[model samples]
Target: MTSDSESPFLQSARRTLQLEQEAVGALISRLDGDFDRACQLILKCTGRVIVTGMGKSGHIGGKIAATLASTGTPAFFVHPGEASHGDLGMITPGDIVLALSNSGETSEVTALLPLLKRMGIPLISMTGRNGSTLATHADAHLDASVVREACPLDLAPTSSTTASLALGDALAVALLEARGFTAEQFALSHPGGSLGRRLLLRVSDLMHQGDRLPQVALGSPLRDALLEITHKGLGFTCVVDGQGRLEGVYTDGDLRRTLDQYSDLHALSVDDVMTRPGKRIAPDILAAEAVRIMEDNRITALAVVDDTGHPVGALHMHDLLSSGVV
Candidate 1:
């Protein structure tokens, strides 16, 4: 039944996005004391922020809860209807409530107001009307009002929901800044993800250790170092002194350069072709940091050194890549 001449549908779609975009923009101009107080409350909240809403507003509330939780503010969403049916136990006196409703008069959410008040919990309501019952009962009212709904019928939650989401993001970010939340702390909470891999994984975890490290004595013949590289399968070897201090590194690139200058590979010692005082990393450094160092210097592998600059381990770009740190 669809056709190329669906001009009305296209116009409606464009209008909806435009209206939602404007609502989000309006949220910034409306922000004032209440917004600041909401952030302060969340930052000081010893317990979680319990987010509650009904229907479409509930969907937006769920995302808001996730955003707050990930950005240093501990939060979780609770369905208003379920809360009335005993999920109210989830909200405690130490917790703060974030209630979302476009009309600001959802019966399910309103029913919990007295109990929340009696328990001495703070209420932050995101609603379109400042005079609505929910707003009147709230300790802080975030204006999520839109001039009109994006729907042609003016019944859908589009613009109002967009405003609510933007305001929620603002609150979460403000709390994040007030708490001095760092990227490392955020990564700790997200330890199962790529962020965790980048922050928590160390070079020591991926670098070849003990007998597997590609290493040879400083005066070892180039052929013997090449044998070490082959045996370790890292495409390179560290050249160390008798005291285990890193003197230099020999790589496939060095082999190619040596081949161009002198055809006698067997007669050369590792010291003749090795790159001196080559790029190195500490074992405790993040693998992502190691990748950064390698990428910044345009090199493939680095010798993992100890406190006194002795080579304790070695790693290649492929090692980081395979370990999901690159």
Candidate 2:
């Protein structure tokens, strides 16, 4: 797809992608008892899963740790080299150690095997070799071998790392299912994310209440309702009875219709111009449900009512948008 000089590089890129794809695909058949054992070990672990690796494998291990932790498995990544230093103190007897090494013979990773054993910690090894030192010492060995690297020289940790990462994802997802990890729980782990906003945010968290709410008596002058709408900037005002129970709603749109139907604007009460029994929602509903109601009814706001049908709060489309619930 390029000029003659660039064609060779493009071909190389295509070949690399093809090789990596095959590498991940090859791991499908490799899932066996060992993979299940790895999940079991982590599930049984009362403490955190300590993931460690060297160089590029460390990068992949870090990503795997994040995936596991966010998906309900308690995990964190520590560098294998750092473990030989005072960092090994971070590992306790209750923790499980997951070591990543393409060759299964990285000196730094292998060095921790004895310390982990002395502490009575369980070991799960992901490696390219089945009989290497780390794999042989592991309680569970995940075979991550690849036929060849995407690098033409087969010297870089290309295909092997991809396969290991995929295998780690498989292990995490399996454990997630086994533990019955729910989306709400996942949202708790990621409270700063948009998914958390959708799953955990409720109507009360974003609704305007008290002095911020716009409301008027049902029998009040239309001018009084209009003043409430203009002052509150919610595009509408709730018309309520003496007991504060909602009787109707009047919005800017209703005002337009009122002007066309009545010549004497000063003579009308809010009850005559308001939409009676206006669309309302409870304060406990998910903000997402409120969004659906607004979209379905082609309206931009709703009155939040309590069990007694009294207006407690006002919600507008802008509130949802500003709160990142829309």
Give the candidate number with the greatest TM-score: 1
Report lDDT per candidate: 0.90, 0.93
Local accuracy of candidate 1 as per-residue lDDT tens digits, 1-326: 44567798786787788899998998888988998888878777889999999999999999999999999888999999999999999998799999999889999999999999999999999999999999999989999999999978999888888889888888888888888999888988888888788888999999888999888998898989999989999888999898989998999899889999997788899999999988889999989999999999988999999999888899899988887777
Q: For each candidate, C-alpha RMSD in Å?
A: 2.7, 2.5
Q: Name every residue pair that clashes in candidate 1.
A: none
Q: Tens-digit lDDT track for model 2 on 1-326?
A: 44567777788988898999999999888888988899889999999999999999999999999999999999999998877888999998789999999989999999998888899999999999998999999999999999999988999989999999999999899999999999889989988988899989999999999999999986899899999999999999999899989998999889899989999999998998899899999999989999999999999999999999998999999989988887
lDDT of 2 at 253: 88
Cα error of candidate 2 at position 234, Å: 0.9
Local lDDT at 170 for model 2: 90
Worst 10 residues of 1 by lDDT: 1-10
lDDT against true structure, model 1:
0.90
Supply the global lDDT for candidate 2.
0.93
| lDDT of model 2 at position 36 | 84
In model 2, the Cα lDDT at residue 37 comes to 90
Residue 52 in model 1: lDDT: 93
lDDT of 2 at 255: 86
TM-scores for every predicted model: 0.95, 0.91
